[model samples]
Target: MAVKTVEDLFLHELSDTYSAEKQMTRSLPQMARAAADPQLAQAFLDHLEETRGQVERIDEMVEILNLKLKRIKCAAMEGLVEEGKDLIDEIDKGPVLDVALIGAAQKVEHYEIASYTTLIALATKLGYTPVLPLLQASLAEEKATDDKLGKLGQAAAIEEAVQA
Candidate 1:
């Protein structure tokens, strides 16, 4: 790993996401289990399924693009996920805890969105249209996930946190 071309970065990004998504597949269940809100728990579970699909799509895109996966460490995702897990551990049965968890989850989602957005731009500039659809699909899913969390925040206990 020396970073050189955009393609190099592209492969690195893809590999980072591959690792991050695998970690998330394992983390999501724990997140769901820790969540006191059924909706939030189910959202994590649902995203788990989506993450699995995204992982597969990444694999497909790699193959379609004829690039080898270069596993680079995703420090950003690691920190975001660690912070999320800490939120779960620190929170008790209260609206404040739920609000904190929402923020933590949103942070995770934003990280993924940012990572995927960069990859999509790289993939497009590299003329990998075949992979674009898959990346775009993942992008859309991440955006939808973010929006869902936003909606939940409006009616969620987080709203009280806002007022207070």
Candidate 2:
């Protein structure tokens, strides 16, 4: 996984993204369970399924592109998941907790969005057109999930404030 060429960089990014998505599948269920709001819980669950699909797409890209991803863990995603777990442990269960969860979820979404964006750019540069649709689909889901979390977070924050 030496960074000798653009293709090497692309493969590294793709591998990182794949690891991120896999980490997400395990973390999302915990986030869902910790969510005070049923809607927020469902959102986490829904995204969990999407994350699984995303992993599959990455697997497809590996086969199509004949990529050999190194056995690397995405440290950024691990840190993000740890933060979410911290919130779940420290925060009391209620609207405030719900708001916190939304924030945590948004952080994950933002990271994924950045990962996918970079992957898309790299793929385009490498002329890896076959994998473009898969990457684009995942990016779309990440952005849409972020938008949903934003709305949910806003409402939850207002509710928490009024309650406070």
- Give a tens-digit lDDT track for model 1, residues 46-146: 99999999999998987898888886767887887898788877777456666776787788788889989999889889888888889889989999998
List per-prediction Cα lDDT, in the order shown. 0.84, 0.91
Worst 10 residues of 1 by lDDT: 155-164
lDDT score for candidate 1 against the true structure: 0.84
Which residue pairs collide in model 1, if any?
Answer: none
Collision count for each candidate, in order: 0, 0
lDDT of 2 by residue, 21-124 (tens): 99999999999988878988999999999999999999999999998887789999999999999999998877887888888889999999999999999999
